[model samples]
Target: MAASPTDTAPPEQGGTPGAAAGFPSLEEMQHWTWVIGRMQQMMMEQGLAALPEVPGVNDAATIERLHDFWSDSLTLWQRFLTPGGAAEPGAPPADKRFRAEAWREPAFDLVRQSYQTIADHLLRGIDALDGVEPAQKEKIRFATRALVEAMSPANFPWTNPEVIERTIETRGENLMKGLQHMLADIARGQLTHTDGGAFQVGRDLATTPGQVVKRTPLYELIQYAPVTDTVADTPLVIFPPWINRFYILDLTPEKSFIRWATQQGLTVFMVSWRSADASMKDVSWDDYVRAQIDAIETVRDLLGVKAVHTIGYCVAGTTLAATLALLAARGEADRVASATFFTAQVDFAEAGELKHFVDDEQLAMIAALSPEGFLDGRYMAATFNLLRGRDLIWNYVTNNYLLGKDYAPFDLLHWNGDITNLPAKWHLSYLTDLYRDNLLVKPGAISVDGTPIDLSRVATPSYVQAGREDHIAPAESVWKVTQHFAGPVRFVLAGSGHIAGVVNPPAAGKYQYWTNDAPAESLADFVAGATETKGSWWPDWQAWLAQRGGGQVPATGARVPGEGALPALEPAPGRYVTQR
Candidate 1:
């Protein structure tokens, strides 16, 4: 047989045989091990240097406290070391609390203590430094936090006590399920933590009755059926953020803002934005503004109104402000009678944690990955989850991966998971011209449809709402619009994060809002004089709209269209919204 084939075959050059061959080579693994060892050594040195001499360490009181803590910790450690027993030292005093069950282990208790001490000392070191820029400092803090999170003992299955316990209890079922979920997520290119069938777009959610009066390449104009005998003469047109579905505003019968507004005897119109695809990759900022203008015109023509009350939510509000600027430049400033921004910012100077991901290098990387010149929604969803890693990423990893529990169906989580793509040109333009450049505030830095955009010139009476705890657009940033826009601006600071603050209805009765019309130089000044109000901001906003709404008229079941238009395209929450 001239040297058997198996004997003549060369050994694999890569790492181990079987499935392990797909992983890093032995040499590469060794190199990383050395690198990590060096990093840990360096961190220990920095931490030691950052530590101050303990004040009165030898004092009786200090010694007593230390002894007590050590005794308690050692007792807990002893109990944990015993099989079939659960005893663990609680986490140390730290702002970012760890929730992992692995800390129940005696070794893990020490691990956490060491990590916390290192983190605190590192943070103090950064603070003691003299000349780092604020943004750079923020970057350093975020990086340090990320590193600390990554190095948690709970992150590794073999080292994690809880994962070990779960594996024993479930007899490897949990591990198998975790592997399945991980593979599924990899297949989908996204982390999904809710049942996909939890809510159907038209039937379960976005169920409010309305008609899609017109359809454009970019959006569908939904003219809702009146809920009352008569409606406000000036129709209300809402521009919802295109990143997610428009259904968020029309969630369910009880929580729907659209339903609430229509019930208040106001003609409601919503622009349901289309999910961008490769075909829309070249769509620019100007294209979006143009589509918005068209929607406004279409709604105005249908309702037979010269001017309409406009509302924008989140990034949609930013879009509205820019559109208003475009309209003003074209001598159509009167097209909008009033403007309402819900947790939206025209200025990006103080845009909170979101700014950390928008630097030049990150932008370039995103652009390169968008080969079709569009960012897929799945990627966007992943990127957003990373922004709140503890809650969105690790929590699910623990529940679905370590515990093998299937995700519970949640409407909000489902909506959140149901993402929409962003046109490459438009996204890049937003990040560059608006976010990075801070162009909208700069007098003539931006132009749309042959018109230079300047927000300061938009004097239409405006209602600006900001969430007090909004990590996306800080209330202070949203409030900055008041200083820039020359209008009678009413600023409302609601008590929650970005979406919850805006979605809050009186029925929920969860959060309160603050109001103060006294002109103040800055957000801090305004907040200082503001008085807290009970209940939702919805009623207050409706009250404001009631002031500017043109007199009421008999509500019509029939759809109306402006000059040179066809009949209703289809029923509301139309085709575009139902698209996957």
Candidate 2:
């Protein structure tokens, strides 16, 4: 052995000679195993660190400490159950009286049920791990076991009655606050009713300001003074979504985009969607397109403009796209000079969870509810609220109900709460054909008035704007319009969700947009290629319209043609909005 070093090695070191002298000690191997196990446990515990903090809580550190303590205790118990543990197979069961006592309450029982459900699922996962590789098996086993242990009912802080009682008391206090707020709103509504009647009576006492005398059958176009000196060669007509009131662009003095465009010298005319009536129950998508096209023709005849720039918002965008495509296919592309879509869904593949509620079964239920021909306004409002439960529903509960605060008087909220009804037949057709089938994006997938809506035929100059955080018409889905339009397309990605993005005013705090004329392969690619800016989209839009609007012309002095002949419906922002 002294002459040949190789002959002195230990067999466990896989050496026939003295090379075994460098083998790791058994103590070192055990220490490494212990370190790796602890590391895995720590990693598992840290995986859910991104979860939001509990509301009104101050003991996050304490909760984490408690979790660690329980995890360690569970590890110890698991180790005892292993083959190396001293405890025999039939050894006396560990005391479970504390666990039983802790879970005796209803809240604790609910926690136990949740934990047991998770535990059972994890066990099933472990059982399915038989086919996995050895290393992967070990990791999965560690993860599953650690998760199950962590989810034990005993780890829940609310297992203590004191915590549960405190939470209940807090909730009760919030509810009282919400009730007070609701009562105040009711009082305000009553006051408004009294004041509104008085204002009508006192109307003759005040001098009437010089108002615009433009008389177009279109209520929205009434404010736009027709060009008398030199009208633009191209006409402009807007197709606003019927889901909301037409005044989204005409919100208020400072916030109105319509007003801004008018001031910037653009001949703008918005579509005032007719409120659905019992007689309009059977109106379908074709009827809407026909009506809109008729309106466009009327404008063309009146203004003697060669082509019109058509702009659409939300659902109206899809309708406009369809109409443009239909016109192009029929060799009538000259009718439209350009097309702009705001937060519209031409492609429905990625329309998100709203699609979940538009399936066949749900459609049938909706049909049943709308047997009289239109989906009720309250029903639509409820559906929208469901999509944003935490923000729209729970936030109100916390602020108005729980905190005992006075209801914040906001015009925006009032406008939002002003719901609108949808014609049942049209709504059904929209959901089934557009959403369920995704017909608009596909060639010849949908037909309006027997004309296939082929996007390849749309040669108008196009501008499409989508919101980044829009849950209703997601940016990705809206961006699909670019693929459909065969024109110089400018896609804009705006900040905020669907409604806020469109209603954004030229305020300092407002967000801007990213736009590109270059063709984008996908929404992600477009975003990657663009730069960001800050400010409302109003200014940019104003600039764009200015370029297309030609020079400023003298305002026309015409009165609405059918005003005296037709019924003088009540003043604008009518009775229905104030109903609820």
Candidate 3:
């Protein structure tokens, strides 16, 4: 069956099935007994490439940790062999992998405990390395984690009690279905995270009422109808990350930030980006900054307003910051009345595990992988999956390929699976200039449209928000933006990861945010002084907008797309979002 691509490891494109390579004797000998093992062979097909070698047991600190590992293993073995109720060693806290009741058996329990013990010691041993740089240590840890996650017994049928029980109950039919799933996935060259058929862009997702007012080679501008009789005088334009479609902000109506914002007495506009193609290889950072400026100007022209409020979520936020800088450099800072950044980092110095992938070798590999200068989105998704290997990769491997279960029907995962390509020039610029060189935050360090960008000159009032647990844009890195912007900044820390933290709507009331009236340069000090608040940060943000002279007027006079300056190209959520 055909499927949408997911943000996990892609299937092996051409290599032979791993079982064929690992067990050449399988074809010559009886294969019935090895059915389960054969079903799991493909999981090992894509090994971690270019992992840094970790420090071995050379020093006393490392030797001591190794001894502790052995000592723990001996204790677990003794407990397993001893008399009844000798207390089976516990698995790591909150580890759902071994939660199956079938795993309560002494042997499987021992397997779980043993895996946990070694994994713990392995990490601790890395901590004991003295001379390694912090960044190098993190890279080694990331690579080791991928290896450790792959080695879990739960990934294999023979050792996994749950899989074994299911196999016996189904009389081996589960293995048959699992093998079929494995082959189907291999043929598609991508993993299926959610039921792809469960949702479509126009029908179920991105269903908020709107029209594509302007379409360009780079992006489409969407102007949504207002819900209230009165709207703020200034329209709010949202620039979502182009990695995926804009629907993430306009999911189902209940979850749609776009829809909800309209009802909050504000005119809403969205920038739906076109996925990069072969021709866009040379469309660099200047084009993106110009695109953002173009969108802002387009919104202002359509509304007949001097300035409009702006938002940049994730990468869009980073681009928006650059656009702001560009505007400031040109003495046109009034174009954007107020700026809001959602989980965006102006400074990459304290970025998370993603920084490890920015070095020269991997980038050359990435460049070689995409000959047309159009990097397939799956490769980026694969890198993201590596950061959360267990939940996003191995979990799906166990469920879809080993247990023969269908993936859950989820809206978010559907959006996540929709892959988009990136322009190589823009991508390389981001990796080398922003991430590797840490140049974006430096005044005049990088130029957009040949104009040097100076963040200090960007005196536009700003609201900076970060997710406390965000791995992609670490909150610390995000918090540093507060120090760079010359304008008054209010920093809020949300209570989730990157996607969830930003997408949270007020009506959902799901996660809380923290605020600190007391000023602090460091995120730790900022967080320590922050007061916890209940519910979503949306209301707080809306209130912030109102404070910035986002004054309201009767909505009966408010104009819709095609009714004013620009012609409505088509009904939104636009042709661009649904293309893939």
Q: Which candidate achieves the best TM-score against the true structure?
A: 3
Candidate 1 has which clashing residue pairs, if any?
301-562
Candidate 3: tens digits of C-alpha lDDT, residues 1-580: 1111221222122322433333222222213312322222222221111112235536666556655665565555444443442354565337888887766664566567678888887777778878899899999998888889999989998778678666656666678887888897678667778888899999999988888888999999899987887788988989998887888998888988899899888889999999988989898888989999998888777678999999999889999999999999998999899999999988999888889888899889888977997899888888887788898889988888888887788998888888888998898888889889989888899999999998888899999999988989999989989988899999999999888898888878798999998979698899889999988999999899988756677765335667776777889999888664
Better of 2 and 3 by lDDT: 3
By lDDT, is 1 or 3 better?
3
lDDT of each structure? 0.76, 0.60, 0.80
**In model 3, which regions exceed 4 Å deviation?**
1-59, 85-93, 556-558
Could you give candidate 1's per-residue lDDT for residues 1-580 as a string of tens digits? 1112122222224433432323343334334433443344444444434334446576554454444444444433333233323333355334333455545333444445555555555565566555799988887877776666666555666545566556656667898998899899889888877878777888778888887878889999888777788888898889999988988888877888998988898888899988988888789888878888888887777666899999998889998999988787778989999999988988999887677778989899889978997888887787777667766787777778877888898777888888898898999889887778888899888888877888888889999999998877889899898988877899999999788888887888889999997878988898899999977999999999999987988775343332225477788789998675
Per-prediction TM-score: 0.82, 0.65, 0.89
lDDT of 3: 0.80
Report the poorest 10 consecutive residues by lDDT, candidate 1. 1-10
